[model samples]
Target chain A: MQEKVHVSGGTALSEQDVHSGEIFMTEDSLDCAFAWDTGVAINRYLTELKNGRIIATECRHCNRIMLPPRLFCELCFKPSSGWVYINDTGVVNTFSICHVHWDASRIKEGEKPYLPAVIEIDGASAGMGIMQLLGEVEPEKIKFGMKVKAVWKPENERTGSITDIKYFKPI
Target chain B: MAILERITRNIDNRFWDPGSEAFPVKNRYTAGMAGQRFFKEIKENGKIFGSKCQSCKITYVPARIYCERCFERLEEWVDVGTEGTIYSFTVVYKTKSGKPKESPSIIVAVKIADGLLIHRLNGCSVEDIQIGMPVKAEFKPKAERRGGIEDIKYFKPL
Candidate 1:
């Protein structure tokens, strides 16, 4: 049976039997709020993923495709004309050894020791990358320029999420 | 278009009723590994330590995992002397709930021997914590450490 682990505070856990929801406040509480309307973009991105197609906004002017797709073409100085479907294969760019887990609920349930990485898709031009978890490689073995591929969740289980791509592993 | 109109009308209404009810909010926060270690040390040693950037030879008080200047990972730990000079300060008369309190709180930005730290100034009148004033980091009882900035308690004039 595949076991799920909860990670929080950059710490790892043995199992996923615990979770917590607690409210905390600090001097910068007001500064943490967001004024964003990411709903439309998030929904569209997920819908494409459900169809087993990796979609990114491609700029016709500059010919660069943006992931976590953008409303505007960053390089061309024009709006994204439409979407571009990409292959699952990519190259691992810069990455980090995340010794600590980030979410409190995951840590409360005892999850620790996972590596997150930024992988640049092959067709993406110049400095474009996606930040996601790196799987199937021990943290020590990860290095620059490693070849990896996206391992997607089952179609039945797919959600319109960055998390829909379960992880990337060495080819 | 009607939705846009409603949004504009709501803004106009809020301009007149400053305290008109808004969505209720719940507090939430996340601490990084470096932050966790910093607070853990405060709870144990009553002293503060900062991570020094080996590349730029700069130090970050309340230690950070990455150097803000160079964007390099900082791994060296260094102890900052308790005493430092106040860079700036403010006296806050309102509480977290935006209500007035009997005793005002004094907040200060302190430049330690290595880097800058922002915390409260306690054990003195609000007038005592001044710009360029020499002060030292002081801690409260072990039980008072709650994994927050309050861990330091405040800086006192030396």
Candidate 2:
């Protein structure tokens, strides 16, 4: 007969015991709050979005027009010189159909999977893109470099955040 | 760039109120070697046990498998009884939400044998508590305990 494993003070917990939740375990969290500081660059970029427009910064050092404008040129390692209006139109550079929420909860059955995409914005430097969602199209039809346009929320409802643009749709 | 000359120096002044967001994360903690026995005893037998380090001539609460100071293997178990003396204490007037409480609560560090256990002191007023005051552990009803610290509900004045 196998004696019941007793631990007066030895390693009594085997790998199987822990895996089966037979040992003492508890759930905890970081328990922290946070705030976001969208400095001079993204701050103004978001402000422009509230007015149903897009903007980009120009770095004279490298002659690049950067979307979601910031103060500095990342490549040239210098400050950006000026800002310019960028078009709301773009192309779907890449995308994925997500079956679950970011936290890993599944979407309700019969509901559509979210279409998160990276869109290369018009008037920005080559390869510069923004992460947005695609709507009003079938998941099976989404393709590379598909022409798309930003669908903005009404002016009165707009908040100075990325949500100002409701989504992107095929142009 | 004609726009460069007209750009104001304070580029940040024109923005709106700052936004806040959260990314909640989950975590887990497991009871290891010594804690397994310590908690199991409380959960199963409604008793508290501490490891006795004979060479160091000291005992630890929530017992350990090794002597922290002497580096000796502590195989002897000492039943540091539920009764104890108030080693230290404090009174709390603020709630977790930051509001001042109508009545303050007393917290005590009860020294059972040579081990110290920090827990709530109920069934007594704040003014009635003092260092070296005798107290005893009040175990929760048998069915309610799940082999954790909550097995002992609180320490009360004996």
On DockQ, the leading prediction is: 2
Q: After superposition, how far is residue A90 of candidate 1 from its true place, in Å?
A: 49
Off by over 4 Å in 1: A1-171, B1-27, B95-100
TM-score of chain B of 1: 0.74
Candidate 2 residues B1-158, lDDT tens each? 32343335565445444334455778766777788788888877888999999888888887988887979889999888789999999999998778999999888899976788889999888767889999999999887876677778999999
Q: lDDT per residue, candidate 2, A1-171, as tens digits?
A: 989977564556678976784587777777666555666778778889999999999998898999878778779778788889999999999999999987899999998999999999999988899899999899999999999999999999998888899999997
| C-alpha-based local distance difference test score of model 2 | 0.84
The sequence of per-residue lDDT tens digits that candidate 1 reaches over residues A1-171 is: 887777634454222312231111243334333343334344456677767667777777787777867667656567776766777778888888655544332333344457788888766665688888889888888889898988889988985556678899988
- Error of model 2, residue A169, in angstroms: 1.6
Could you tell me every candidate's TM-score relative to the true structure? Answer: 0.43, 0.78
Tens digits of per-residue lDDT for model 1, B118-142: 8888777975556898988887789
Please list the residue runs of candidate 2 whose C-alpha ends up more than 4 Å from where it truly belongs after superposition.
A1-33, A74-77, B1-28, B53-58, B65-75, B113-115
